[model samples]
Target: MTAHGLVIGKFYPLHAGHLGLVRFAASESAALTVIVLGTVFESGSHERRADWLRAELAAAGAELGHVEVLAVRCDAPEEYGTEIAWVANVAIMRAALAAAGRPAPTAVFSSEPYGVELAARFGAEHRAYDVAREGHPISGTAIRADLAGRWSEVAPAARLDLATRVIVTGAESTGTTTLTTALVDHYRANGFAAMPVVPEYGRDFTYELHAETEERLGREVAMDDLVWLPEHFARIAERQNELEDAAAMACPLVIADTDAFATELWERRYLGATSDETHRFGTDRLPPRDVYLVTDHVGVPFFQDGWRDGEHIRADMNGWFVDELTRRDASWVLLRGAPEERLRYAVRLIDALWARNATFASPPWRSSPPSVE
Candidate 1:
């Protein structure tokens, strides 16, 4: 019944210092569980912080089998203090372990002011590492400042990937697939790695819905019986995760055909209506992008694929795409022309992007790195 060690933190942007502490804890304990404090503030969501922590851990070789990442929501104002926060955190951890039917932890790992006091309450051994001299201590305040446009002072580890993974998004047959493929090829030919987004589960699920709900006289179609009124957003979320993981493994640039944002557009347009859940998901679930390539109406002919709507619907979808991009405050390049012409424009835009950007330094952990394949 001896439990593993626990490391609790907001980990707003898990940097080198946090990783060092985690590694220290892991070496000292039988196992290490990183408890990420969630819902601490309305500024950044729990999911975003958790994702950032997971990726940082992965980069630092701490995402091994022994380490577990868990999130606990702490929305109450009282949960921000030392003792109360520790009690709530311990209770949450116990519940989480019980739910998983695992042994309770025997130690708590941290370097914050409350480390010893918090450990005492659980009757667990406490280990404190000094964060002041550990690694590069780039705090959340500094990171937010950098993200607000002060890039020069940002730590190297805190910077985003120089060459971004951009997704070309739109409704069905809005040239997303075509543009994505062309961009990948263009980047590859120019001696850079650009991968098209692999179609995720939602596309397959949508295809299935089409096959079931509609009859194909000469083409595939979704049946009317299987409408979008009762669609679940879980499929979109699953796909988004898959895409993110794929991009992480990819080379300099990863181009996605469509993302969760595109799915939201379709759901709102075709489904009965959008709800608070859908809106929140759209607001939070979409990945942050360095740049967004939006294809405006280029008078391109709409292909009548099984899932595709008509020209009028396509135009309407374009408006929705613009609106969503505006809402997100994303800087975008509006590509307009025939499919091939649009492809050419995308290539030019990419050229501009690369010209203005610096080369990406190879991540320390990546071995046998991918080339433009």
Candidate 2:
């Protein structure tokens, strides 16, 4: 007979341990339902945890099609492992399963001792794994205490949501790519194997579009011959954001040559001014940037890459970046002087950004204070 398994947890910030347990459950049953229990006081949202599990399952080739992720909220004041908490928690879990049109689970999988009671309440068998956390040797509590230090414990998808996104943006030929690569190298050289650098998608898009247009006309076309449209920029901006987001999820730190937010300025530069639609597609949809490392054009010579407009516009674009980043109250640093000096300052800024973002929000519950005399 086939068995349906159930696993429940807050997964306040889903970690590798949770993934291992879920995988174990999937192995023991034909189908598995993982409930992400959440409370308002938790730092991370329940829905986001569900999304992470789904992404993880998709990536786990063996368990891809059999696992289901669901979200349920429980704010019962009763402490876990108590009779009252069991009764309350079980009821909520049942209601959630019913609302999702799922049947009572045949087996319950967990890393906690309460799995026995939880399974008993649902007339299911308890299959516990790693009650002592010997395998993963990690917990949400420990991870919360030092999220940055314990980053490897976080699930891949959750890492993206919590990672610091640093965008290197400035005018054309201002060494944005150079600085981005340097940052990635700095981190990877120090043992961060997962550091991903997202290249500027807009540049590729522009090149491809120009090539196609030239092909249709059966003639070589100058960059100036290309036409600009709001929709074109909108597509570029959306794709840029997509690239950055994918990189963020893959690693703890994302260094992008340019990003959707910077696309807005490019739109203005090419089209005289940004259209409302361009902003909506680009800057308006930006994920929270930890910081932007802007390359200054003051001392840097602009190289006329075939696609570049000209050297004259470099200073203008640099100024626009500063003004716009300031208007949005965004954290940014201007990188000037030699390439090595620029990289040193960029590293310092990124280290600071990592330190700041590494701090996690404390969970709501607090330990009891010493009794007063």
Candidate 3:
């Protein structure tokens, strides 16, 4: 008789430790069913965990031969040491199997102690997996608490929440977008898939303003107009935050051209006061970024395309950024000199950060990336 096995977990972030138990059961059983039990009050959404679990199972390939992954939104009642939770969980399992025309599990497998008790209720055998945490010694809790320091423990789907976001920002014509786009390409070519680029939302939004004002009105937008007219910045901030967060899920490092904070700075400079809605949105909604690279405007060629501001505004805003960073004592570094020089210098800083926190399980990018100089 072929053994049908079951494994259950919250998979809060679905680290390697959970994968080990799933893989172990796969090797031991003829067919395995993995249950990702989620509640209304879990850290990650049920839909997200379901998607991540499905991806991992498919990626498991022949190593986990016949397998299925299931996600349930069943909320086990909160009662310490009560069978209410266990009973509820078992009911879901039985109902799920029956609904699929499969039999009740012949064996229950798990890395935790509950497997024995769970299996007993179904009159099935219990097989304890790596209860000692021998193979992959990591936990979702540990991953959640210190995500930057524990990047390798998380699945790709969970990375958006845990990955380090490096914001490249400065005044127009400072090569901010150039560096951001280049870094993403460099990482992908060098074997880091999650290095998605969050293109400059503010820059794109500003271009629209310039087009409308300069072409239609046939006049350049004055500083007073930007400062006093407050609505557009708010929309840009919300959009920028969305774009950055969306890009974070696929890669370990998010290389943003500029984040909302940079947008806020420009709003402060051009508009005396930013819209309250946009300011609060950036402050409360956006996650804390890992670092900032502000490109220096000194000696850089300032091109005045029909849409761009003059070199004077670019230079003045760059000084304001430097001053603000000094006041806040934030995590930041200056990218100065030629294009090639700036790229190389910024990569070196990021490379050091990657090395210090790397766990060797996450993909590596330590080799020298192609230099432009």
Highest TM-score: which candidate?
Answer: 2
Best by lDDT: 2
Report the C-alpha lDDT of model 1 over 1-373, residue by residue, as the tens digit. Answer: 2258878776544455566777778777777777766554434455655666566667667345477777666543333345664566567757766776656668877766567766787688777776464455454445433332333333223334333557687655667777887887877776554343556456678676666555544464444445564336546654664665456344445566666666667677767466555555556755455566777656766677554456777777888888878887877777777888888877776667654443222223223211100
Model 2, position 44, has a per-residue lDDT of 60
Higher-scoring candidate on lDDT, 1 or 2: 2
Q: Model 2 scores what on Cα lDDT?
A: 0.80
Whole-model lDDT per candidate: 0.60, 0.80, 0.71
Candidates in order, TM-scores: namely 0.53, 0.69, 0.57
lDDT of 2 by residue, 174-236 (tens): 888888888889888865677776989888889998999899899999998898898888898
Q: Model 1: runs farther than 4 Å from truth?
A: 1-163, 192-196, 200-202, 212-223, 352-373
Which parts of model 3 have CA positions greater than 4 angstroms off? 1-114, 117-157, 210-228, 360-373
| Model 3 agreement with the true structure over 94-172: per-residue lDDT tens digits | 7877776667788888776566778898889988876677777777656655555466677755565546678898998
Which 10-residue span in candidate 1 carries the lowest summed lDDT?
364-373
Give the clashing pairs for model 3.
194-250, 194-251, 227-271
